[model samples]
Every structure is written in structure tokens, then in C-alpha cells.
Target: MKILICLSNVPDTTTKAKFVNDNTAFDTTGVQWIINPWDELALTRAIELKTDAANTIENITVITVGGKDAEPTMRKALAIGADDAVRIDVEPKDAYFVAAQIAEYLKSNPFDLIFSGIESADYNGSAVGGMVAEFLNAPSVSAVSGLNIEGGQVKITRDIDGGQEEVSVEMPAVLTVQKGIAKEPMIAAMRGIMMARKKPLNVVAPVEVEALTEIVNFEMPQPKPACKMIEPENVKELVDLLQNEAKVI
Candidate 1:
């Protein structure tokens, strides 16, 4: 089995987010980039599948859509256990555009299975995986928490509103993985890190896709209001405030 895992370069969770270039683009200066956390689950599962003897998954390829700066994250994925890496040299503008570029890339090489995060941490738009599946005319399952492969078919369990659902699909499908499906991602060791430098990383330019959305401007959200304290002894006053002043009741 040849599995393709789609990764993303995103700002570290602790990085302070800002906009620049007249608030039209994200301010990447001084930002530390990392692999999208949700993608880690997919990567981990891919690695697991490759290790399983019954499945015999031969190669695990990791791909990303981003500029030059994204290569490090791709390398990181390789270091973590991906056999190879591909970086689409483009600054992703929107989910649709990114999906189109990815779909174009996959058009040439039909993979047995494709994996990606449920959503990117920065944009939080969970549209790319399904869109790519649609473009490839493959079955798609999103936010899958459990996955197993048997005889060229995939069995998946995904979380619903109150429970989980089990699904089955054949090979040559796309899956977007969510958290809780696996443990936290493992860090690359020294040997893995050294080997990653020798691994193949194919960089390709993105195919042109007419962008449908453009950012007009950006504004920070309103600051949260200060907290008001009420004395424990003022029970009646609190009730009155909830009824009349706060109107929360």
C-alpha cells in the first residue's frame, strides 16, 4: 500500500497571531512554524499501518502546500517516519484553492489511500479533504477516530454528536483524521533526523487555479469585558441582578 499523508505548516500554538501588509495577509515574521497538530494523527496512523505486517504498506509519502518556509515542516514529517515528502511551492490562500492544487497533483499519481488533518489549526476550515476526494472521485470519511485496513478495504470509526459511527470504504479513498484517534505524535530521534536529510523531497509548483475568495481587510475581535465580582453574602442581590440588571435568567 502506498499512503499519502497531507500535512500543513502552521504557526506554533503559542505564537502570537498578527496580520501584516495592510492587514491583507498573515504576519509570519518571528513566527515558529510546526506541523498541523491534527495532521499528526493521520501521520501516526499511516506509520502504524506501514508497520503492520498484514497490511504490508510499503511507502508513506507526506505532502504539503506552502511556500519555501514550509519545507521544514515537511522534513519534520519525514523525520517522524514518512518515507518521502513533497512540497507544493505555493502560499495557500483559501481552502478551495489549496484543495484544487492538491487534486491536480494527485491526478498523475493515484495513491492507494490519502490522509490529512480534519482541519488546519490556523484557518480552521475543514473543507480541503472532502474537496480533494470529490476531485479524485474517491470515497471520503472525515474526522475519523479509528481506522483499520483489511483486504483492500478500510474500516473507520468516527465521532458524531453524541457517539461514534462505523464506516467501510474500499481502497483509493481519502480520510481526514481528528484527535483522540491516536496518542500524541512522537518526536523524531537523532537517527531519524539524520536519515530525513537523505530522504527525497520533491518540490513542485502549484497549478494555477483561479481564486474565488479574497481577503478584504482584517480586524481584531472586541476585547472581553472585565469580570464583575459579587459577594457571597449578596445572594438576593445576585438573583435580582440576574433578573433585571444582567438579564441572564
Candidate 2:
């Protein structure tokens, strides 16, 4: 069995976000980028699945849609344990375009399982996995927190309203993993980093796909107001504020 894991590079959460191109595109200047934290869960889980009994997974290939600027994150994924990597040479415009590129590639190179994060850290658009599944005509499970494989079938568990829901499905399926799918991400050891330099990182040309949405402009959220302090004796005033101004009740 072969596994395809989608990887995404995003700005580190500490970085201050800025927009360029007339406030239509995110600026990359002096920004630190890392593999999306959610994607790390998918990668580590894929690695664990590949090493389980029966050894069903022959390869865990990580793929991403971006230019050379994203190669560092791909390399980091390789260091974490992906067998190989595929870099689709395109600037990721949106979720649809990126998923279309991945789905197009899957038509020629099929896999038994595909993994992606439930959402990206930057845009938080939880749309790629389902879109890829739709384009490939494959079954998909979203927001899965636990996974296992047995006898060529995958057993998945996810949280519902109050409890967990377990399901089983055959191969050739897509899964969008959420938190708890894997613990902390594996730190790339020096040996693994050295090995990653030798691992195969293939670059592929993107298939044609028109973007369905365009960013016209970006506006950051307004600054919040300062907290107010009320004396203990102002109980009646607090009630008035809650009823008329704050309006919670």
C-alpha cells in the first residue's frame, strides 16, 4: 500500500501577518515559515501506520503545491520520516486550486490512502481534503482523531456531539485528521536531516486549474477595547451595564 500525505507551509504563529499586492496578498518579507502544525499530525500518523504489523504501506510520499520557496518545509517533512516528496511547481492560490493539482496527480499515480490536515493554520480553510476526494471520486472522512489499519481496511474514530464515532472503510480513501491524531510532531534529528538531503524530492509541473475565488482585499480585525474595572459596591451599575450595554442577558 502507498500513502499520500498533503503538506502545507505556513507562517509561524508568532509572526505578524501583513498584506501586500495592494492588500490583496500576504507579504512574505522577513516571515518565518514552518510546516503547518496540523499537517504534522497527518505526517506522524502516516509514519506510524506504515510501520505497523503487516507493513501494508510501501511508501509515505508527501506532496505540496508551491514554488521553491516551500522546499524547506518539504525537506523538513522528509526529515520527519516521509519516504519521498513531490513539489508541484505552482503558487498555491487557494484550496480548490491546490486540491485540483493534487487530484490531477493522483489520477496518474494512485495510492491506497491519502492524508491531509483538517485545516491549515494560516487560512483555516478546512476544504482541501473533501475537495480532493470529490475530484478523485474517493470516499473521505473528516476530522478524524484516531486511525488504524487491519486486513487492508482502515478503522477510524472521531468525536461526535458528545462521544466518539467509529467507522471502517476500505482502501483508496481520504482522511482529514484533527488534533489528537498524533501527539507532538517529531523533531528532525541530525541523522534524519542528513538522510533527508539524500532522499528523493521530485518536482512536478502543475496541471491546469482556474481559481474559483480571488482575494480582492484583506482587512485585519479591529483592536479590542480596554478592560473596565468596577468597584465591588457598584453591583447595581454592573447589572445595568449587563442588561443595557453588554447585553448578555
Lowest summed lDDT window (length 10), candidate 1: 180-189
Expressed as tens digits, the lDDT of each residue in 1-249 for candidate 1 is 899988888999898778988887789898999998988888988887778889878899988888888998988888899999988888888888888988999999779889889998888889889989998889898879998888767889988889999999876899888987678787888999999999999999889897778779777889889977789999998899899998999
Indicate the residue-level lDDT of 149 in model 2: 80
- Residue 161's lDDT in candidate 1: 87
Error of 2 at 247 (Å): 2.4
lDDT, candidate 2, 1-249, per-residue tens: 899999999999798989988888889899998988888989998888777858678899999999999999999999989999999999998899999999999999999889999899888999999999999989998889998887777889976768889988766999999998898877888998999999999999998899998878998889999977789999888888899999997
- Report lDDT (Cα) of residue 14, candidate 1: 93
Q: lDDT: which candidate is best? A: 2
What is the Å distance of residue 199 in model 2 from its true position?
0.4
Residue 52 miss distance in model 1 (angstroms): 1.4
Local distance difference test scores for all models: 0.87, 0.90
Count of clashing pairs, candidate 1: 0
Stretches of model 1 off by over 4 angstroms after superposition: 231-249
